[model samples]
Target chain A: MLEVSNLSVNYRGIRALDNISLTLSPRELVGLIGPNGAGKSTLIKAILGLVSFQGKVQFRGKPLRRQRQRVAYVPQRSQIDWDYPVTAWNVVMMALTPSIGWLREPDHRVKQAVSAALDRVDMLPLRHRQIGQLSGGQQQRVFLARALAQQADLFLMDEPFTGIDQKTEAIMLEVFADLKRKGKTLLVCSHEWGQALSRYDRLLLINRQLLANDRPQVVMTMENLHRAYGQSLQTTMGGNAMGFSFC
Target chain B: MLSPLLSPLAYEFIRNALIAGILVGILCPVVGTYLIVQRMTLLGNVIAHAVLPGLAIAHFLTIDILWGAFVSGLLSSFATNWIRAQTRIKVDAAMALTLASFFALGVILITRLESRLDLDAFLFGDILSVTVKDVWQTALITGVILLLVKLFYKELLFYTFDPLGAQAMGLPIQVINVGLMAAITLTIILGMKTVGVILVTSLIVGPAITAYLLVKELHQMMALGGLIGALSSVIGLYLSYFLDLPSGPAIALTVFGFFLLGLLLRPVCNLNRENSVGKKLGKKYRSQKSEVSQELEPDA
Candidate 1:
């Protein structure tokens, strides 16, 4: 379980994330959704302590920062340098570095974990290929494998579905289902819409503040969308598709 | 055949220079691999140039110049980070600003003090003039750096490849970053004697990039780059000895020469693999096209 209370992030003099509070339970998949610059990523960063914030985030009754080893984060695809000279195996092996201890080689068990993670994502065959040589879907799968290899209780992913192929999407959905079955907690930041939103047990609609946090059907209301997206939605969507009919 | 090379090793100065150069060759590229991967080669140049002020201050304060250089180099990097954090100026622009100001300050201090420090020697290192003590210092630094690198390779790799993920995993990313900066500064300081500040970036970036063209792993790049660096230094020393060229420039040019060779040879070496993969894909596409045509023939 994870709890975030009174979390606020400021960039320069501007408030990027207004006072926000939320909690996530085990075996739940929560989707974080909002328009661009809606502090979705910032909120995640604040929770992960990647950015400074004025709030408290606790996991399993301890400060989240102190319990970082029990958390796994999959950053946005754009955040990584694809040209980095690392293979999928190397990328996944990074998850076990802390456990392997300093100056010690990865034992048989460590390598097994890495290979099993890659195998779970159907990427074991391409484990030795350079990350840059992999397709976008393959790259995302590699990162997913890396997160899985971490064997963390809480999973935080940023835009895991963006620019990925359908096969990757299906694989991710299956993996998420499996993780939930295992009682793991996942908070995914997404830009998805329509029926796709129903896949989440709950959706946190945000735009600098927590607009709504409830079942996907309850949170996908027109009023909630309008409150979070504001007039930009009308401008971007030409005001004709204002109804939340798709969901 | 080997007499010409063996003859140079007989001179004490030549032997010391070779020892120092070889150590520098091994050290720069190992540290430089981090720079190349992070796309922070310019930062290496900035730190190298930033050492000038430290050297001048060290002379004025009558302390070891290496300490002064190391501190100043680290300060420059910190200053760059501070500027980037406080303002909207990008990292590259901040580095440029920091590099220019530090170099200017160093020049002013050197001129105002009328110090005995030779600016020419600092700008263009006189490798042939190195003493036994310098060789010993280089060896110690090399040993310490290699040991640290071996111990922390995984952490460094993780941090370099994915800082946020490493931080999220409780790796103390800030400490890792500062450690890397310290290592880089120490390497730049070591290189300052053999390659000088102006040409040191070549030693730091050149061999690593050369190896990058040939290898697909970070450790491989460092290993191959170390080999290339050592080879370049030895060859450059020989060229300088036989051709009567400046030692620093000769070495720098040798690094460039090796980089060009790597670039040229990379394509030829990878061609076979690429061609094989390309042929397989070509066959698959052709088969798919034929199958589609066969299916369409009945419809037509």
Candidate 2:
């Protein structure tokens, strides 16, 4: 379980995220949806302590920082340099680095874990290929494999679905369900809403503050959509359909 | 050809210079691979220039020049980091400010103190004038750097590739970063005897970029870059001996020439073409996607 309380973040003396609070239980998948510049990414960064925030975040009744290995994070695709000369296997193996000990290569155990994680993403065949040569979807899968290799109970992914192919999207949803079945808690940031928004167990709709925190059907009401999107609702939702297609 | 090449090896100073050149060649490219991948080649140049003030002050105090160089380099780099962190100024502007100010202070000190030391030797190292002590110092530093890199290769690999991911994993990222900075400073200090501050960055950057274009993995890039660097140093030193050119410039030029050669010959030799695995993956992914998309449409 995770709890965030009174989380406020300021950027250039402007409030990027207002005092916000949320909690998640074990075996739950929460989708974080917000308008552009709604501090979706900032919220995740603050939780991870990668940015300054005036708040407290607790994981499993303890401070998040103290439980680092228990939580795995996959940063936005743009945050990484794809040109770096590393294989998909290399990226996945980074999860086992702390356990691999210093001055040593991956042993048979670590290699097995890396290979298994890569296989889960169907990227094992491309293990030794340079990561940059992979398509954008494959690149996303590689990062997912890395998080899988971490074997963490909590997963925080920033925009894991953006710019990915349909197949990758299906694989990601499947992995989320698989992780949920394994009693892992996941918080994924996404900007998509057509039929895809129904997949999450809960949706936390935010715009600088917590607007809604409930089941996807209950929280995605037109009123909440208006509050979250403001004047940009028509632009964001595309032609006044007024809600997610699945809804 | 043999006599022209063999003649330089007879003198002790020339032989010492040769040894120093080879060490610098091997070390710079290995370290430079990190700099290139991290997009911090400019940072290396900044630290190289910043070492000058330290060099001048150390000369004035009649102490070890390497100590001053290392200290000043670290100070400037750390100062750059501090400024970037504390203020809104970006890393490039901060580096520019520090690079200019530190280098200016060094020039002023060299002029004002009247130390009787040749600034040219520091700016453009007179490698041909190297003593055995310089060679020994280089060897020690090279050994230490290689050892540290070997010990921390995985950590460095992860850190260099993805800092945020590594930090999330509770890796001591800041400590790793500082350790890397110290290693780079040590490398630049050792290189001062061969390429000097003005041309030292080229020595660091040239071979790494050369190797990057030819390899698909970081370790391979480092190994190939080391070989290229070593060869360039020997070849450049030989050219200096035969052509009566400046050793630093000759080596820098030779290293850059190797990079250019790698660039030109890549397509000819298929040196940088995607490997078999990559090609196979590309074909399979395209075919699978097409099949899937066609199934979804089922067009007339």
Best-matching candidate per lDDT = 1
lDDT of 1 by residue, A158-218 (tens): 9999988877899999999999999999999998776788899999999999999999989
lDDT of 2 at B221: 88
Please provide, for model 2 over B16-117, each residue's C-alpha lDDT reduced to its tens digit, 9 standing for 90 to 100. Answer: 988999999999989999999998889898998999888888999999988998999999989999999888999999999999999999899888987676
Q: Quote fnat for model 1.
A: 0.67
- Every model's DockQ: 0.45, 0.52
The worst-scoring run of ten residues by lDDT in candidate 1 chain A lies at: A235-244
C-alpha-based local distance difference test score of model 2: 0.88
Listed per model in order, the count of residue pairs whose N, CA or C atoms clash below 3 Å is 0, 0
The C-alpha lDDT values of all candidates are 0.89, 0.88
Q: DockQ for model 2?
A: 0.52
